[model samples]
Target: MDFSFLPKYWAYFNYGVMVTIMISVCVVFFGTIIGILVALAKRSNIKILEWLVSLYVWIFRGTPMVVQIMIAFTWMQFSGLPTISFGVLDIDLTRVVPGIIIISLNSGAYISEIVRAGIEAVPKGQMEAAYSLGIKPINTMRYVILPQAIKNILPALGNEFITIIKDSSLLQTIGVMELWNGAQSVATATYIPVEPLLFAAFYYLMVTSAMSGLLKLLEGRMSNGGKA
Candidate 1:
């Protein structure tokens, strides 16, 4: 009831909000690329590459996400690893890098499955027809297979992005100042837990709902185009 504390500690909340959005966006973009690669390797004839992809996916997917974050963070800290300087901004890679890497790896494992399923759902005849027309394998996947497969996978990818948005909250364990971290800091400063947490929850709800709405609109367009 006493969210009077919100105005007092808005800066911390902003930090948390920014961290979550930045991390989730970077993770989703890079994760999808990594996922596509893994999916391709899974379906490729190269035995050793397929095996390596399997191992990476298995390790990332099977293990707890928090464990990955901690391991990456701890390794970087203990190794005295250097932070990245981007001219105007310096990134503490020990914090942001590990958080992004862990989340991206975890997402890549799951997204790989989504992508593979999408690739499989495309009709085999499509690939055969492209081949008969003398399309290269790369061109077939690029121009023929992927566009159709994306329609089936878009919703699932949106959901994964939502999941990443929420899951990044756990990065507080590795000293990433994400959403939950904002709540915790406000709670500690104000000695009022529920209101700060509720505020954080409101931000999460707003972001996820907006993303869901956009995905629905995209799906509608996709469906309508198919009809036309």
Candidate 2:
């Protein structure tokens, strides 16, 4: 129960925090794009495209993310399928790549629904008006529907980003050395579990709380602007 170990191990904790942030940023960046695409696919007029997107969302959402990461990493390593290759060179995808992919895919499943809900939240009148203006469906979505929908969904998207920040901890199970892994490493090395674990918890709390505050501020501004 040495309280003094916190300051001594702050550097390791900081490094871990940085890695966690990096992973979360990467996950959100790619995941948002994937989610938007999936959302659009789910709403496609083509039945096959809608069905495929539905299946993807159901499978990823139904499974545990840790299990998904394990499977992805193992498959990449053992499948002998080159993740990327040029004419003469091949690159093997490792734990980190699959780890990020799994997390991003999982995040996309949830974000897709958020996006779908956002799109649906727009009034039918908006769609009809766009159509009356001779706007193609794609342009209606691009210029009118999605912009309005995004405004409605910004708060939810922020919440999902915060969720991603926390869920990034699960990557530690695969030896990705994110925040939780760093805390675990410190605990194993120093034999003082509580302090390091608490430090990690504190870091998570700080991040999530800051995100919540920012989202709230953004939501308020949007609300005020809408009123204006």
Identify the leading candidate in terms of lDDT. Answer: 1
lDDT of 2 by residue, 1-228 (tens): 566777777777777777778778889999999999999998889999999989999999999998999898888766454445433323234656787899999999999999999999999999999999999999999999998898888988998899999998887877767789888998998888788898889899998998899889988988888889
Lowest-sum lDDT 10-residue window in model 2: 84-93
Q: Which pairs, if any, clash in model 2?
A: none
lDDT agreement with native, every candidate: 0.90, 0.86
Error of 1 at 42 (Å): 0.6
lDDT of 1 by residue, 105-208 (tens): 99999999999999999999999999999999999999999999999899999999999999999899987778898799889989997999999999999989
C-alpha TM-scores of all predictions: 0.94, 0.90
Candidate 1 CA-lDDT value: 0.90
Q: How many backbone clashes are present in model 2?
A: 0
